[model samples]
Structures are given as C-alpha cells and as structure tokens.
Target: MEISNMDPPTRAGAVETTPLLEGDGKRSVQAVDVVPMKFRDMPVAAESIRKAFEDDPLMEYFDAADTAPFPVSRRKLIDMVDWMGAMHQERMLTVEGGMSLMKYGPPGNQTNLPSVAFLRDSLGRLRPEECAKRWKEFGAKARELVSAAFGEKVADMMEIQVLATDPDAQGRGYASALVKYVLRQGDADGRDVWLLTTSAYGFYEHFGFVTVRSGKVGEDNPAWDGEPITLRIMHRTARASLAQASSEPKSPVMYTV
Candidate 1:
C-alpha cells in the first residue's frame, strides 16, 4: 500500500493531538500531533525508536559485552535505525512521542548491503564480517519460522517493521495511534499485517493481532546468559474496520515454532 499520501484521521486541518498529563492528575503539556514523517524528522524518530527499545531483550542480546565481534553499541543501532528511516521514509509515520515504520509486500531485500557496508566502514570498530554473519543467521531462522507458519501467503502481507513510543509517552496512546494508522492502510489494501516482537504481545492483542508462532533466539551464543529471548510472530488478518475487529471475538490459528 502506498501510504505517503495517506493521513491519519485529523480534525480542523491539523493532525489530531493526544493530551499529556502530569503525575498529579492534571494536564501538563499540550497534545502532540501525529503526522507523516518528514526528512527533517529522521533523527528524532530514530532516537525515539532507539530509546523505546534500549532495554528490549533482542537488543540486549545484540549488545551483550561478551558477544565479541557481533555485539553492537547503542550508537550503531541508532545509526541503523536512522538509515532505515532514510530508506523507507514514505512508510514512516511519527508523532513527537512515537514512530512506526511499515512495509507492504514481501520481505525481500529490505536493506541495502552496500549502504550497510559503507556504514560499517565509516564506523570503524563495527566488525563488519561478524555482524553480517550474525544477522544472516538470525534472518534465516526468522524466515524459516515465518515461511513455515504462513506458507506462500507470507508474500501478500504487510509488515510492521518497527513501532515504538518514547518511554515517557507510554500511557498517552501514541503507539496505538501509530499502529492503527498502518492497520487502516493494510485493511484498505486488503493485506494482512504481521510483525515479529520480543515484547508487547498483549499490547498488540488489543488491535486484533494474535501470536501465531513463538521461539527462542540467542540460545546458540555461548556468551549469552539467562534464558534465550522468546520472539513471537503476531498476525492480524485484514478487516473492514478496526472497530469491527475489536467488537468481534477472535480465535487465532496457531503454528508451533
């Protein structure tokens, strides 16, 4: 779906804003507007996504100090997110407190290897070979699970690549707005929406996504401690409207990971 021209529902020619409240049960700040992300918004949007996932399990695995050569710093992750926004700006939507990047069609070559190699060269300490190997392994595993769960229909779906709300903005509904905006586009285009998430399973459930497969990653790394992070693949079939989907009960068809 082409979402560049699509605007979230708004009021009075201005993007609708959600109110920010204080700890004392009173309004503290003005509502922030949700809009399509612009080139100028890239840095802020990237930072927001990075901050939102700073403590995420998957990120922690990649950032582990003992994971020699493959470990990535926060700065590198931020740069990667910034690059992603640059590559797919048309599908990136942002508000002051949040951002979401969605992609339509098959999950083909989503990243430019040459660009990433350039980035690795520029960033000197980023061990390109090891990082590439780790990413390749992870990608292959993820694709294997997804293909097993969805079969050939995986190519027809829309993907929620990244959805994040700044930590302070958690209760303000920015994430929900971002998610719903993409979901509306998916529904309009007759595409099911799917995503891989290490957390927020319950959060997405409210929007009609149900966990179709679940598996542990990072278990192969001997340097990793504790239980391997569990990744869940969530899917939401196309529906006429978000309201209609929420009003009806759903029984998800599950696939073992």
Candidate 2:
C-alpha cells in the first residue's frame, strides 16, 4: 500500500511512540497504554510479531511448512518486515496493514504440496515439548507488544499478527481492553470488525463477532482458508455498530478457499 502526504513529525505534534515498556519495578505485571506503531518501528514490532506466532501451538504446525521446503518459504515471506514496516509509516495505510497484512499471517504451515507429509515424517526424531518450549518467551512478548500497538485493528480482517498482553498481565483486562478498543475503532471508521481466530473464537463472539464459513465469506484471505488449522473468521454482526453494509452477498458460503 502506498501513501502520500503526511503530517510531518514534530515534537509536540508527533505521535510519541514508545513500545509499551512492559513489567513494573518488580518485573511483574504492569499497567499499560496503547499507541500507534510507526512504519520504521515495525522491525521492532516484527521482531516481537515473529515471536508471537512462534509461540503459538497451531502456528508451529504452520511454521514447519513455512520453513520446510525450497519454494513457498522463499518468495512470499521474504522481506515482509520491510514491506510491512514501510506501510506503517502512514497512519491510514497501517490500519489496513494492521488488519490484513500484519496482525495475523505467515502461519508456519504452507503445505499445498508435500510439506505436511514431511512434517509427519520428521516428528518422530524430535521432541515437541522441548522444541516448542524454546520460543515461548519471545512469542509471549511478541503477543503483548503487537497487541498493544495494533490497539484497535485486531478485530478486523481475520488473521493477522497482534500482541494482546504481557505474560504477567493476562486477566487484568488487557486482552479485553485491547479487543474493545479495536472494536471501537471499527465503529469509528465505519468498517466491519474482523478476526481470524484459533484461540479466541467464542471470546470474540461474546462481543458480537459472528463467525463466517470460508465458502460463504472471504476466500482471498489465507487465514480464512483454514488451510492447516480451522481458521475461524468473525466479523461484526449486522447489529454491531461497526457492521459493514455491502451490496455483495455477505454470506460466508460465497467465499472461496
């Protein structure tokens, strides 16, 4: 996405962005605030973003495919940080990025070919617990940071990388706070809230995020394709303040895998 014309960065006028410094003096859960993550700042966010997906159990299955072979891994994910970070430089473009491109993607599973079989063949040689344990910290931190930054966009566009809360800060309303914030943004922008969820489907539906069957909804979204995992896409209900009005038939059955 390309954007031209922006408010020049200045002292008081600039959006003061600091990755929400997590942890209090005790190195325990801390209170937090949300802020816009800039384009230049995405490398920082990307580092955290990569970690978030890495820690995910389902994502590991996807990553085995992502990092496995010679081809799919080579092209699409290459230089993603730079590609995405550049868009974040603009406030407007980043919202779309935050929704579609950044918040939830790059699942490890890319098996349209033989990678799944390969992953099954290799599972016996390694220990799943030991392997997945290694990246937990980075992944956990990534979740918190990106969620804070995405702030209000996580509820849209199905799958996207996003941070929710610090490991120590869960259950203190950070995730709920963040979700509500994103939903409010959707309402403000007059756009439907979307999310591709594995862990939080029921949670989001509680907030009126109704699920759509891929065949009836968005086929263009890989997250909604439910390739390796059952990727559930939820959007604002017609009753939601952020519900989108479209002329196209809006049923999930209209989607293409």
Report the number of the highest-TM-score candidate.
1
Residue-wise C-alpha lDDT for candidate 1, range 175-240, written one tens digit per residue: 666677778878898889887777677667767888898777777867557568776778999999
**Segments of candidate 2 deviating more than 4 angstroms:** 1-32, 39-44, 55-57, 66-169, 214-228, 238-257
lDDT of 2 by residue, 65-150 (tens): 33334422232233233344323332211221222112322112111124423333343223244323422322333334324333
- Taking all chains together, each candidate's TM-score versus the true structure is 0.72, 0.41
Output the TM-score of candidate 2: 0.41
Candidate 2, position 191, lDDT: 48
Candidate 2, residue 52: lDDT: 35
lDDT of 2 at 91: 22
RMSD score of candidate 1 (Å): 8.3
